[model samples]
Target chain A: MNKRRAARRRGLAASDDVMWSLMQAAHAVESQLEEALAQVELSGAKLAALTQLVEAGEPVALGELAARCACVRSNITQLVDRLEADKLVRRVDDAADRRSLRAAITPLGRERQAAGAKKVDEVRRKLGKALGAIDHAALKRALSDLD
Target chain B: MNKRRAARRRGLAASDDVMWSLMQAAHAVESQLEEALAQVELSGAKLAALTQLVEAGEPVALGELAARCACVRSNITQLVDRLEADKLVRRVDDAADRRSLRAAITPLGRERQAAGAKKVDEVRRKLGKALGAIDHAALKRALSDLD
Candidate 1:
């Protein structure tokens, strides 16, 4: 097994295994969340953007929204476009800075977000129950170290 | 903070935080790997399929490749199409089983996979160094539980 040991020391084999596990775990969590979001007819991306609007409790500038979403301004533009097409959000000219544009959540957006959150919470609770025996505190710590 | 406590009890806030961290950590690792793979003109999906072929050390059925890659057969079909377009792999009819298709790696495929592995190993080693302080054994178990 010296070959395996050498590969491990080179951070090849062991790291590959560990990294793959991390990704698979993340995928498991994401897939459940995706399913829950689908029930509400909201994609993970759409819900994320809508949720940001809900949390802001007011219109947010497109640039600021992009920053908050950790997405590029161009992507945010397209996302906002989709949200607008869905009638969940609208593009409003920034009152204070006419040159800037902002995204405002419509009533439909808030309603949909609340629905999506409810569905998402069900999956989260199920997840917590399923993983309850797993040391969440340790898992949380380990995940943070990755970031 | 009663709402916060109630939310935690319901497994909403805490799970969301933990789950979000997990996805973000996965993203961090994935982003680094993606950037590295891009250097060799390889996407993660392509590399994963190519790596599977390399590990098999022989022509493998497309269905088996899908199973190994944990991808849908339909998705694998598209992926193989792209790989074939890149001239990394070619499809050959399985002799023992008529009407069955298998993927055989080309010499170029082997060469590219070796090159890709070298680049990937560099990132994996860097990941190992960065996460060296963390408890890998515990992390691996926790992640496996997720799957």
Candidate 2:
């Protein structure tokens, strides 16, 4: 009556193992990156926000930050609150729109972002070395396909 | 002094792009899996715990479950509480030690886990097919190295 069930592996299928391996590897890499960012007192989201501000070279509207961050206004509000508390970013009145508020990265924010990014790079390089034993060309192809 | 920075690409390095591709692919696959599990009111963590319980075929000690789940005991406690509230699991006093508690899977939990596992398998199969163009043996080698 349930031949499929009997035919199935005791725990997971081959695809499941492959998928789980991908998640596990990502988690491992992310944890290391998070640790590197944490040393600079910056979380991933905070750095991302600061990066956008630094790239913009001007304050970005809260609404725009929300859109770029792929989050809602309230979450961006809370995230900005955290960033503001850290003195890494400041909320300023938008000259373009008086009613709106914009986020600008402080000098310290730029410094910390730079430092955190370097740390992240170091970790990535280390990861690259650790994963270097394999064929990078093939790995890149597999990864790009997942995109 | 700034030669390294100048040598770097505008945004990310080759290694950074590779690392990011890994994260992006993992995120894409995980999002698809999460969407499938959401229909059964099960999260990755919830299903993980349920799967352990179903496999154990008996109540599992909280501490032991935490160790098995690679989480702290307190996190396991809260997770168990959530599972209990969802009627997927119940807490029972451990016979070996009355002060400690163990988690037992409900019949409903078993049914849902079976269904959820089916959905996960389906998604994994789809992903496998999507990625089937690549050599799985090589990919598996790369993934195993990440471990």
Candidate 3:
């Protein structure tokens, strides 16, 4: 907290301060990650989707993609559209569900994802080192609690 | 890491996986905090502003608010505008700098912030306990390095 800003306090609540700190910390982490990702012209959302596809090992239905990403179907559609525009992803009709569409990563998309992954890995190692052997299971549980 | 999702993998990049995990973790934390704040009809942005105002101990200019929140001036303007409409904040022209506006939290705003703070504290404590202790200096250094 900046000293000048500290002077403006009227009736500060402790819990709010804690919450604020958590958010600020999260923001700090995100901004750093975004800057790193910007080098590859990828946003976190785009990277997240690509990562999902890469991890999925095969073509995934668009609706399944949305569910996996914890985002809405419409948002997934828009994301896929952008990815397709970037030539990072392609939409193929689902053979099993004609009503649904499958999104598969293009070769170029995989390459981009690989490069982005390397950069992100560097950032994450730095974060992990900073956070220090973070209890990932605990974090996962807490996150699930939130969902 | 669901097997179903993992089965779709081409060849998971270590860094990409780490980055994705961090983001998912952060998103989980944010969603949890947001849900708690939402109970009082306060979005994360609004709660952040309110928390900053309460912490400031006095009226704060928009620029200062933006700095504390690590957001853009335009975003701060919009957030304050909404906060003012909710009667949670009142804008006062800075006597020293007429061009800048100061936002003061109203009594209602204080109350809401207080309520938000309580819930936030509970969540933080739970999360902190779960995450274990994070090295403040290392984390701050890492965040600053990324910035």
Candidate 4:
């Protein structure tokens, strides 16, 4: 029984190592991207919000924006306030629900989002070159499966 | 020339899609881990600091800690203050450098670090299961190469 348990522990450790490596890689990539975004007066959070809005192709419910940003509703409100102040996004009354609000990207927001996306692509391209040996198709397949 | 530019744009977009997917995957995994760490009263930043100390196996200078944590010196000071308040870590004058202070983990800190590591491992295991179809060895190789 002790031997069996030891074997199981070893297996778990190996698995943990892989997960740790992935986390480190993600953190490194994010740190680099954050620095890049900062040059444009954008943060990872703001970029994420803008990215969601652009992808949404229309105003999204405030609650849905919060969900997509993986942030609390109050935090999303503050974020939207900043974005609105920058004239990158605007809030509108929900047509279907009079009491609710939605966030839509303004033309300026779209322009900024495009610029941000370009920066992200540049950074990601560098990362891809760095990890060029990896099978990107396989990686994409795996990530898609997770979703 | 226009056709070539359009084709290149298409290629870049496809590449961007793959990169975006990876970012989303990483975000999902990190969010889950952050939630798990919160149950132990540890934010991702604090946990990162603790992990660094544990790995160093000795006291780490405040400036070095800031660099490792990817924050400013003042930020590290505040973070260390919180950790000290919790009695998980302490600050001591650097023996090698009298002008500097170093942060070290206490017995409680070590215990907490172990607990945090366990929680991280558990969450990572779940992520692994979610991406069970991926070639983990290849993924590890790719990430390690990045470093």
TM-score between candidate 2 chain A and the true chain A: 0.83
| Tens-place lDDT digits, model 2, residues A1-147 | 122221131233323356766776777787888888899888777877777677678999999887766568898899999999999999999877788999988999889889877988898788788888777767766866764
What are the lDDT scores of the predictions, listed in order? 0.76, 0.75, 0.69, 0.73
Ranking by DockQ: 2, 1, 4, 3
Q: What pairs collide in candidate 2?
A: none
The two-chain DockQ for each candidate, comma-separated, is 0.28, 0.29, 0.22, 0.22
Q: Candidate 2 vs. truth: CA RMSD?
A: 6.2
Query: lDDT (0-100) at residue A15 of candidate 2?
Result: 33
Sliding window of 10 residues with minimal summed lDDT for model 2 chain A: A1-10
Off by over 4 Å in 3: A1-27, A127-147, B1-25, B128-147
lDDT of 3 by residue, B1-147 (tens): 452243223222433243344344456677887888889888777877898988778999999888877668999899999999999999998989879899999999999998987776677777766554654334333333322
Cα error, candidate 3, residue A60 (Å): 2.0
Question: Considering only N, C-alpha and C atoms within 3 Å, which residue pairs clash in candidate 4?
Answer: none
lDDT: which is higher, 2 or 3? 2
Model 2 stretches with alpha carbons more than 4 Å out: A1-16, B1-16
Please tell me the interface RMSD, in Å, for model 4: 7.9
Predicted candidate 2 versus true structure: per-residue lDDT over B1-147, tens digit per residue: 122221131222323355776776787788888899999888877887787788778899999787767678998889999999999999998877878899999999898788888878888888788888887766766765664
Q: Write the per-residue lDDT of candidate 3 for residues A1-147, one digit (tens) a residue.
A: 442243223112333232333344455677877788889988877887898898888988988888877678999999999999999999998777779889999999988898787776677677767655555444334333322
Task: Give the count of colliding residue pairs in each prediction.
Answer: 0, 0, 15, 0
RMSD score of candidate 4 (Å)? 8.1
